[model samples]
Target: MTVADGTARLCAPAPGGGDLGLWQRVIDALRTADQWGSSDSTGTPEIWAHITEGQR
Candidate 1:
């Protein structure tokens, strides 16, 4: 999945939504947090990399 500008773009699943979906969900959350930015900085949602289970 790809998260950009606070919007989430999910990839088509192979069959049943598997680990990729789960990983995507986690990544989306992190991306959201990152988009929120640090309290000291202005909040501007930016494009972030896809997060996988291993990276967690």
Candidate 2:
């Protein structure tokens, strides 16, 4: 997700279309300092990437 100028752009599709809920959850996770580095530890959000961010 791209958090810029106060807006978080999650999963961009060709540029604009993306999941708003996912972005919100990502923001929440980051804001809460929750475990967000791995799928196994990120809880039920099921949104963590298994690979490096650059790889994704």
Candidate 3:
């Protein structure tokens, strides 16, 4: 997950069985805290940019 500028990006592995609901809850909790926006795609350029920005 990436949290920045009051927004969050969640990139989690595909859950198996009944864990989908559990994952949703975790994402909801993160959104509640950030309140700006959210996305679940790991390939998003913005998310990757934010992640790599700190490495350089």
Candidate 4:
């Protein structure tokens, strides 16, 4: 996924019957880390929230 110009774009390969739950967990982990930032000292939840808004 990429966010630019106030819009977010996502591109991925067609599902090959993989484990969607695992993919969701990976995405969730990434989002959580982005919210917390490095060492939990520079979180940007607001920006992340805006970028990820409406995204699953």
Candidate 5:
């Protein structure tokens, strides 16, 4: 994904954990984003919420 400023965001599989692993990868990517500097501390639950929103 590319932000308005042209920064490209990406997600990649980590090798073993499948969807659960992808969550971590996505969180790591989000944490590194300039727009989301503290994603580790703040964005995890939000991310998981979005990810699992319709599964229930």
Candidate 6:
């Protein structure tokens, strides 16, 4: 996924690592954005929790 301010990044599926790294980076960036930054790290945890816990 691409972020604003004309600064976009990439994440590739590394061999043997599955799809965790890219997902983490995207979530981390989301946690960094001033416009959408989370008050706590709980945001990523919550979202991932939903996906992981089958709540979504």
- What are the lDDT scores of the predictions, listed in order? 0.43, 0.41, 0.46, 0.44, 0.41, 0.39
In model 5, the number of clashes is 0
Clashes of each: 0, 0, 0, 0, 0, 0
Q: Report lDDT (Cα) of residue 52, candidate 4.
A: 48
- Per-prediction TM-score to the true structure, in the order listed: 0.28, 0.28, 0.28, 0.29, 0.31, 0.29
Candidate 1 vs candidate 4: the TM-score winner is: 4
CA shift at 51, candidate 1, in angstroms? Answer: 18
Clashing pairs in 1: none
* RMSD to true structure for each model, in Å: 12.5, 13.0, 8.6, 12.4, 12.5, 13.7
> How would you encode candidate 6's per-residue C-alpha lDDT over 1-56 as one tens digit per residue?
44445544333322234578876876675565333322235432222111112222
List, residue by residue over 1-56, the lDDT tens digit for candidate 1: 67565554443322233678866765566574423222212344233333343333
Give stretches of model 6 more than 4 Å off.
Answer: 1-18, 35-56
Error of 5 at 18 (Å): 8.0
Quality of model 2 by C-alpha lDDT: 0.41
Per-residue accuracy of model 2 over 1-56 as CA lDDT, tens digit each = 66655444333222124778766766565454323343324333334322233422
Candidate 6: RMSD to truth: 13.7
Best by TM-score: 5
TM-score of 1: 0.28
Q: For this target, which candidate reaches the highest lDDT against the unseen true structure?
A: 3
Angstrom error at residue 40, model 3:
16
